[model samples]
Target: MQEPTLLILTALADEPRHGYGLIQEIEAISAGRYRMRTGTLYGALDRLLSQQLIAVEREEVVDGRARRFYTLTGQGRAALAAEAERLRSVAAEAERRLHVLRPGLQGGAA
Candidate 1:
């Protein structure tokens, strides 16, 4: 899965969020490394909705504006779990290789 998609799923894993909330959550999750544009976020949300990975948990009108909150589906939870495991495995292997290459090195940076 793409990084943005992964982040979105992760953000929704804990609780439902509206589009703007998702944008903030994603930015915080990435430690400010990624700033998602509104258009991009909505597009991804639509795609995930179609894929059945996410669903609209609720909709409300606040200050005359409609807000749709999204939550992760069972499939989305499973997918995110799998992706996290895969990433962990890859990182572990990279760490092991790094150790072999530099016996005294404990991590990636010097």
Candidate 2:
């Protein structure tokens, strides 16, 4: 539901990724707007894991460091879908209100 959680879920929607990979994908998805730190990222990952929203797909040792790949579970996918729909609804409402408040705002030059 939160922005970080949404971004994390959305990032995993495409494919499984480790911590660094998730960070890159999330930054890409957000157009470099949200750069997550290591601490924040792992905290969210741990919470998501505890909530059963995501699961570890595999773990590999690279350069003597363990990299854990995570994937979205079925429930995670469902939750993401629901959140997307909710966002669409909210955006639509905002657009409609803006159209009313500022005439010619919709489908016209600002």
Index of the highest-lDDT prediction: 2
Model 2 Cα lDDT, one tens digit per residue, 1-110: 88999999999998999999999999999999999999999999999999999999999998999999999999999999999999999999999976684555655786
Root-mean-square deviation of Cα positions for candidate 1 versus the true structure, in angstroms: 3.4
* TM-score (C-alpha) between model 1 and the true structure: 0.87
Pick by TM-score: which candidate is best?
1
Task: Estimate the TM-score of every prediction.
Answer: 0.87, 0.84
Residues 35-85 of candidate 1: C-alpha lDDT, one tens digit per residue: 999999999999999999999999999789899999999999999999999
User: Model 2: which ten-residue window has the lowest total lDDT?
Assistant: 98-107
Q: Can you give the lDDT of residue 86 in candidate 2?
A: 97
* Residue 37 displacement (Å), model 2: 0.8
